[model samples]
Target: MTPATIPSRFGLACVLGSALLLSACAEKQVILPGERESVRPEADLSESRIRLDGNTARAIQLPAQRVNAEWTQGIGSPAFRVDHAALGGQLQHLWEVPIGNPDSRRARITASPVVGGGLVYTLDSGAQVSAVTPEGAVAWSTNLTPASERAIDSTGGGLAYANGTVYISSGFGLLSALDARTGELRWRQKLEANGSGMPLVRDGVVYVVAGDHTGWAVDAGNGRVLWQIMGAPSVTTVLGSGAPATSSDLVVFGFGSGDLVAAFRQGGMRHWAEAVAGNRLGRAVSRISDVTGAPVIAGDRIFAGSHSGRLAAFDLHGGEELWLARQGALGPVWPAGDSVFAVTDLNQLARFDASNGSPIWAADLPGFVNDKPRKRGETWAHYGPILAGGRIITASNDGLLRFFSPESGQLVGQVEVPGGATTEPVVANRTLYVVSSDGKLHAYR
Candidate 1:
């Protein structure tokens, strides 16, 4: 693997208005598996500069929470937007099963758990894919690692399901179609480079991005590349790639180079490209401009964020910039009705007005481990601000699943994850599935 293909283990950190200042000094104690820390005083945000916009704060509303039957893709849908999914009752601890090998120094699990056909799917750091039942039983398992000396280090691919087939992208430069029920391989195609992100399948076509930043459209039935386009190359990127988001006619992909490109869904003709690159002053991690989170398309707008301190929305038709914010999104921006919720680079879960990109409210999540200052201790990374059951849901590397009020950005409730989550949680049929960094599949009802 080349330098750019290797996943970086660095935590994303940057100053976002007053949130970082408040969170950095705000003292909160969280007990890890084998460690405990003293309680610290909470920073007073009453006089802080970041505040909800008065004009839209009172009018903000989210779509009604609806029960989603299946989460077939990593981001829930081809558009990468699952607005207000219905997760019923108190999320009681249900069952847990080991998925595969956990994250090591050589590889890490970056793909979110995908649920479909009554089974939860996960891709571990070693390129192993496992399917688990709702009762936490391993139904089938398959290894996609290529037969090569360097294949042991392969990591960071994702899964998507459509019809009765599971589409898989491998870090070993292969895309394979598998039987969703039997785990039998149907077809496989070799790509020009290793896969960087999850595959998105829609209407008999599969879309994926490679490590070289190339977008490919493949036939879902047979693993044949229909069309492919090369994107601008970058030497440095965060850990993983963002899955491409698609509408009826267009598919938008975010590259590690901070380029957001939109191409025709059927053909690979470039529609437009925009750079989502910007850096926070004095922050070294902010220099990486990878769009680690998948771009989300809701209605007529496209929302995406980069690690380099930029959260932007663009017109879906012309790819024109509609609004932009300075806070880099740590994960995919959850676009509800009038607001967009994101776990920001500052370790704060913030709500932004989807209309004008105005700050609504920001709630601080766990930042540095042991509540120590950045660089002095390890920082807890957060993923997924998905709106479920009338609350904003976010999973942390600190083994906690937090729920926040969508209306106020206040912490409402939290649950302990067994081994700490490595990626975002996915909900299917009113059940939540989270993949822990220790390679366990945790299911909650």
Candidate 2:
């Protein structure tokens, strides 16, 4: 195909031996559940031209009136996506307080803080959990460590709040329930080790995905195991994963192998399974197929992204593939009324129509590129992007809190935080909260 015939979205062209791109397709390119190994890429998108497609651009229609009463979990409740949220006062820093530990060469913060019941909860190094008031006053604190103090791995495994209790999944393979207000330990059960993903609670059940990609459902009140499902880990994958998105009687999650599956919430029955990976065998860095981004379940549609380069939408009701975009995504996809906002791996902020995989707008952002030379085994860092109050809120590694207009993807506001935020900035009850890698929790009005 010639570049003139391709959609302007990115100047897509696949002229046989000339160039190729997944987004350059003329129509729906259906990738099935079993096509993971068959679809070989002769050329990757490393050389594809990426520019705003004037023909496909549409005015962004993000919901400006949607307000969230509380951010109870890592990705705003269960479905891992929320609509427009209300933010009051100027986008200025109100207060900052230390949480637990600082990010180091050996340890780092990867999970986001959650808020509920007039109190905000956070996890820190050494498996410590703390609760603070909306005014930044310390309410209570407790450590999830055992009597023998072995250095905790990913201590901030996952955090969730429900029914007046705070649920925590730890790196040492322990799931504990605590009093939301007092931080008193109610009960704890040893599950499996290296439970790095966040936990979510719904319908009297607490859900968690381990570092190995095994999903488990435990009793909300007593911590009894209800059901478990295991998935094989990928040979190469990303560092962290997202919480399982749940809606009604359905629960969906993407694995390290680029496989997305929908199962029943009550019995753990498999409803459908589909692979979301594309051929990235061209380079060593492009070989990952990790769906590190949380899947968004809105209404009857499911939106997910992968590191290998695929942004796909699916029909939730029938488990059928809807559409796919070749832009690689690594953060959570924000779904508002009719628009979806995401941070593409190519360092671009993009908006797409939720009904189909059509481009609305794209903006450039300095992505996770470290100019400094690494000595040996160095960990990766990212400036998490989120949608708040109809604005694209980002806390980059540069320690800047920037706000951009959703309509045009233009910079609107910027403020410097004490420490850079590696996790997504969270919003609740008309207030924005950002957790810094230095263990400080900053609240903005």
Candidate 3:
């Protein structure tokens, strides 16, 4: 479809009325027996000894007002033709904004949509950073200097909004802080010559990994560089690497090329760096490989995945390896009750015990639908499985949004977008927001 088509699908009129009718017929929440009794299902929570208290439960609760949240860069889209009304949510086509113009020069948007106050943010391959409203109007667009001679796909970097500022990174190697409301630039810093990982902000600090096997912690409140650590050995001499994670007082990360997991006292000096062994696949590979995903911090242990299919956990305090799970792992992980969700290029959805990385359930999923007609047996890949309201909401690459039961991983309902989905589903109030690859923003109940 041409960019100007503005397909009838990307409008509120087409879906709003249908969604309102469905929302008017609300489904009463069923009080399950598990809520009243303490009889925990073996798989209800991850296989950790730490008991989940009220605080933990409350932390994951849906907020009264929707806050822009992105677990990973983009949400998962399902590979199916769907009816929007059946998904148990209202569906409204908000807006369809075009990304690269008719000219061939265009940037592929791998950065996830960042929403805050009243706007959404994303970065495209053309080194163009864009901000838009939920209604699909462009707020501002700023182009940055390209990092290298070759174009790098910015799929993994994540965006964060804190205080009154917006934090964004270019896979090419740049981090900038901009005003949240207006797209005014506050400060821009070249974290490294090359940047591939997303920045994670906590407290008042921004933790990020540099393309050159180094990690830096900067004060978010003022954009001051607090400390920098030579994460792994030099990539030229050794197979250099670094993966970052953080808690209130501690900063955690792993470096397999240097064979270490290190911790630093927040706002203080680097405390210690301990080695973590290379798995069968080790750290570096022939092409496009490294430790890239953000580490998930749960209780006292921090869990992470390496480029090589190894999922391991380490002590948040001592930087010691607690448990390691060996499996054909792929992509970033999402932690729900007791199970963490991951999808592979082979179209497999696997849930593992977050504590020990033991497999609890695994299933092969359908691949995404391309713009062209799908040939027989062709499939699309799953991008994300966001957990909310006892259901897993996922977007497929082919522009379909689906709802699945967390209990069985079975698809419940789905909606198809004229433009396929490239971002993760954002759930606020009772509305689900999804962005499509063709630059269309969709809202569903």
Instruction: Judging by TM-score against the true structure, name the best candidate.
Output: 1
Alpha carbon lDDT at 405, candidate 1: 82
Error of model 1, residue 239, in angstroms? 2.6
Which candidate gets the maximum lDDT versus the true structure?
1
Q: What ranking emerges by TM-score with the best candidate at the front?
A: 1, 2, 3
Q: Give each model a TM-score.
A: 0.85, 0.83, 0.67
lDDT of 1 by residue, 110-206 (tens): 8888777877788888777888888888999988766663656677777888888888887787888888888888999987687757889888999
- 2 or 3, which is superior by TM-score? 2
Candidate 2 backbone collisions, by pair: 8-53, 9-53, 66-84
Per-residue lDDT for 1-445 in model 2, tens only? 8887557535433354244454465577687675354253543433335434432344565656557767787552334345666875367678988878767766667667888788988877557888989899888989888876565455556788887899987777788999998999998877765666778898889887776777888899898999987766786656547778888878887778888788899799988887777754443555788786677787788888887767888888667889988776777687765777787765667787788877778776664355354542332344556777767777766677778777777778787777777677888877888778788888988
Error of 3 at 222 (Å): 4.1
Q: After superposition, how far is residue 118 of candidate 2 from its true place, in Å?
A: 1.0
**Candidate 3 lDDT (Cα, whole model)?**
0.54
Q: Candidate 1: which stretches are off by over 4 Å?
A: 1-59, 76-81, 149-151, 370-377
Kindly list the per-residue Cα lDDT of model 3 for residues 1-445, writing each as its tens digit.
8766676657767699889989989998887674464564543532122111111111222212233233222221111101121233445555467543111124444455555566666655445667766566788876554444454333234466666677776655677787877777787777765554556676777766666666778888777888887766545311112235665666665443433345454544666665433334222331222443335566676655544445666676776777766532334456665666665323556666666776665555564344344453445635555665555566777667766655555566677766676655655434566656665556665
Which window of 10 residues has the lowest lDDT sum in candidate 3? 76-85
Where model 3 places Cα greater than 4 Å from the true spot, the runs are 1-93, 99-107, 146-157, 233-243, 254-260, 265-289, 367-380
